[model samples]
Target: MLTNTVTMTTVEIAELTGKAHKNVLADARKVIEMIGGLKSQPSSLGYSEATYTNKQNKEHPMLVLDKHLTFTLITGYDTGLRHNVVGRWIELEQVANPAFAAQAITETLNELQARVNAMAPAYDEHVRKGRTVGYSWREACRLADIDHPDKLLAVLVSLGRARKTTQGHTQLHPDYERDGFIKTLKPSNLVVSKNGGHLFKITSKGLTEWLKAKAEEMNTAVAFAGVDRWGRPIK
Candidate 1:
């Protein structure tokens, strides 16, 4: 039997991440694509998580984890990211210096996550409530500074970073036209519109999905996916 095609909308991922979905998903997806393709697991975190709060003692890191970077790590793990060094070229000093290997991997991971967040869809909902003329792949690529915004945007939307307008020219938004691509990304459900051509709100279900995205981070301290929401080890 022929399989039916599937597509994801920003509303779906916003629903997935439990945040205001809409244009945000598009923005996130664009930035992520601009950064480059996705990765499942990265080897490292280049920069340290900054102390986020400016208050006498604020919570969270100052250098917020770039959403795109998180997506890179997730996609990278699924794909294979080999170390650049040729085994023969590895030196004795490199072996002795643990920091060398650690730093390289960290940089890779940080890059991945940083890009994902940058491209995540976070559009102006009040402006574009429903669909309009639709976005051209080339135009999007240009705006986002991505070489292949078409492909990258599709990935981000499918993965829940951003979404596409369902009622537009599928040709412009290739994600709607692609069959297996959507199936592979497998978005959970639903898309929405607040006004003209912007905004996607996360559904109640998306809240849980965004929560699961927490699992996407690369492990810097030897723990796989490291630390549950409660700060407890996965064991």
Candidate 2:
């Protein structure tokens, strides 16, 4: 198990080595005295006094050791105990290193990205040509990677591609009807809150059409701005 260097108390050390707390404190003081010569300099071994609450709910002074000081203290123990302590200290060192953590995170992200890249072709084909019979507004927005669902919903409603009732019920676009897409019945099992609005399901045809329109709009904007798709100024 991993332990924090700064918070590794003498009480914990005693527990780990199956020694008395007082004996561990004595050992720590001896180590401190040896480093600083006669006068007690606890900081010489990165040792500090902290308070720990015992099982009886009483707080008592305890010695804390940083990584370097911890190894020094643990080295005085028997062979088997020394091995265990060294292993834990090694784990603590790895966890505390910023470079190690960053590299670990980078490697994890690279693996995740590699998996996503491997699946991208299939995912793109599904998005472009697959049939989505009944998907809610949120689901549709997620699938399309659209950030503003309300804006798209408003546009759809205004273009007569969708309808909304005063009670917040929505109707599918007629274009989807022409494209052989079907809508599922509004589920009755859900409890409708007073502020809740019904999200109408959309077909894959509707989703594909919306994406195409959005892309065309973006292209038109880019052309008007005299910039390429990558936002570079056109020569």
Evaluated with TM-score, which candidate comes out highest? Answer: 2
**Per-candidate TM vs. native?**
0.19, 0.37
The window of 10 residues in a row where model 2 has the poorest summed lDDT is 187-196
RMSD of each: 20.8, 24.8
lDDT of 1 at 177: 30
Model 1 agreement with the true structure over 113-225: per-residue lDDT tens digits: 45433433333221132133323333333433344434443555555545654653122123323421111111222221212222322221221222112222311222423
Residue 221, model 1: Cα distance from true site in angstroms: 40
Q: Model 2, which residues run further than 4 Å from truth?
A: 1-7, 37-41, 98-235
Candidate 2 local Cα displacement, residue 122, angstroms: 66
